[model samples]
Target: MGKEFIEIFEKWADTYDSSLTKDIEYKEVFRGYDQILDSVANKAFGEVVEFGPGTGNLTVKLLELGLSVTGIEPSPAMRKLADEKLKGKAVVKDGDFLSFTVEKKPDVFVSTYAFHHLTDKEKAEAITLYSNLLSSSGKIVFADTMFRSEEEYEKAKAAASQSGFHNLAADLAREYYSTIPKLKGMLEENGFTATFTRLNEFVWIMEGIKLQ
Candidate 1:
């Protein structure tokens, strides 16, 4: 689903980590990055299939938590960096949200900062695919940008633009970021009990546990 942004990711592979720490515009978006990764790793168990494990930041945390992780990423450049970082600790594969292969069924599907790459419809389809692939009680833990309402989203975009953060503003306008209500409804409709926690002004943690 997020394959459309592969070129951007490829170009970003080298400076991606630095951007998280030094990019003024993205500071708010990645405010609690380490904490968010920790929280996601803490909630995951058993085998994990991680979507968009760019540079293997979350993948490293998952391994540190004693969990086996398979990282699926679409950008070869990003995957290369992740492989170098992981050093063969976890399998980083080439895949995206809607297409991937796992040798065994995963107990958890985890992602961070990447889900917004998919449009709402693609997001729903991805969730449905995960729901069908997972066993009862399996989980999806994702931390990404989501607004509480469309009004807030528009306001944020406007504020960014007014603040001279045209890149950030453009990103908000270009991405398929969804509303909390829409995401929650999608999870529920797919038979998952969903919970959300606000991590920052621009990021939220969404946990969905399959009920059946």
Candidate 2:
């Protein structure tokens, strides 16, 4: 399933940005990024790392803020587009977040609409790994499809069905969506203070601050 998804993304890489602009839901998702970035606007972060940066939309924003950014992406085609878009502004690497390495520990980590590709257990492990990659005062901000509970997942599924998105609804009803409470627990247990805000019915932004 993961490989299949990567293949789909690779195929869509060239047209991803243009396609996103036409998607109303995706536009709303992009709007959530502003809030995510604003949440840490006051922080003094020297370095930032992003997971699956897609075509560098968010990477451009991070670079605009004058912070050095390293983007790790698995899809070669996607990385190519990101490379062309980011150019010298950011270092785009060919790797997944779980195994990617950097010489310098980042002051903050950012990922938008990418983490949901992992299973529940993988998500927990990823958080643990991220915790180790951060400086003592470092933080992580992410926005992705998240549900508060099983009930909310069911509600989203029903709404999707009513809107004529049968396949999408079924996918939402399955184990794809992250559970907010579980995510919070994972972050906290791994030594970060987690906070969550709903961006929309299907997306949520979360910030996790490393504990001293």
Candidate 3:
């Protein structure tokens, strides 16, 4: 699944950002991701780690905040685009988040609209790894999905179908809707105090602080 998804992302690298804001729902989600990143990212000096930066949207924002970031991405093409998008700014590393390792623990870790790509067990283990990879008192800004009240989940499904935006990424969006709570609990279980905030619709945002 990882390799297959990586190939898919590689194909979408150049056009993904343009597609994201084509639909009103996705446009709103992109705007929310930008706003959240602009708001909470505070470790302005030390290196920061970002997972699956599709096209450097969030990476650019972090750079604007006066932080140098190392972006971990599985797709080579996406890496190329990120490098182009953030040229002379961010260091783009071609790697998957699940097993990707770094020698230096980052001062802050963040992922946006990307965490839902992980499987249940992977998400759990990721939080544990992230806790270890973060320096003491490090923070994480997790902006992605959340547990949908069954009714809300169904409503999102119905609405997506109605919007005529079916082909971009339908199945993945559904999978994403269910992954949030498990991820949130995973962060807390790993000893990072977490707080989840609903940004707009299904895309939720969270903040985690690694205790001293």
Candidate 4:
């Protein structure tokens, strides 16, 4: 499944950014992301490590804030695009979030529209890994598809399928959508204080601060 996930992104790399930008729903999501990420920038500290930085859209914004960013992207093609977009402003690493290692603990760890690629268990494990990689005051900020509950997720999946959004239906079937309440519980269980900001019914930004 992991290899397949990587392959999917690799295949979509060239068209990924364009597809998101051209889709009205995704365009609105990106706009909301801009605002959410801007708020993240205000709270960031020394250095930031971004997971799956697709084509450097949010990476550019973090760079503009004068923050040093290290981006981990699994797809070579996508990494290449991000490298070109970042233009030496940030370091692009060829790896996935779950296995990547950092010599120094980052002050902030962030991801946008990326975590949904993982399954629920993987998401929990990733959060645990992130907690271990942060200092007491460090934070983790994420912007992605966040559902209110399992019921809401099911309803959305049904709606998408009925509307001919097969890809979305597939994602739902694969358990790629995160439920906000579940996520917050996981974060808190792992010793982080969590907060959520909803952008819409399906998208949200979350911040978790390591407890002292």
Task: Name the better of 3 and 4 by lDDT.
Answer: 4
Evaluate model 1: give its TM-score. Answer: 0.98
| Tens-digit lDDT string for candidate 4 (1-212) | 14458877878888887776576534544565557667766667678998988888888888888888888888888889999988888888877768786666798998878888887798899889888888778899988888888898889889878877776678667757878889999899999999998875577878999998
Local error of candidate 2 at residue 112 (angstroms): 0.2
lDDT of 3: 0.72
Count of clashing pairs, candidate 3: 0
TM-score of 2: 0.89
| Candidate with maximal TM-score | 1
Best model per lDDT: 1
Clashing pairs in 1: none
Candidate 4 stretches with Cα past 4 Å from truth are 24-31
Estimate every model's Cα lDDT from 0 to 1. Answer: 0.94, 0.77, 0.72, 0.81
Residues 1-212, model 1: lDDT tens digits = 47778889988999999999899999899998999999899999999999999999999999998998999999999899999999999999998999999998889999999999998999999999999998669999999999999999999999999999988999999989999999999999999999999999999999999996
Instruction: Rank candidates by lDDT, best first.
Output: 1, 4, 2, 3
- The candidate, 3 or 4, that scores higher on TM-score is 4
The residue-by-residue lDDT of candidate 2 on 1-212, one tens digit each, is 13436876887888777765575534544555556555544343788888888988888777778888888888989888888988777888877757787768888888877887878888888889888889987898887888889788778778778877665666565445678899999999999999997766567778899999
Select the stronger candidate by lDDT from 1 and 2.
Answer: 1
User: Which stretches in model 2 have alpha-carbon errors above 4 Å?
Assistant: 1-4, 24-44, 170-175
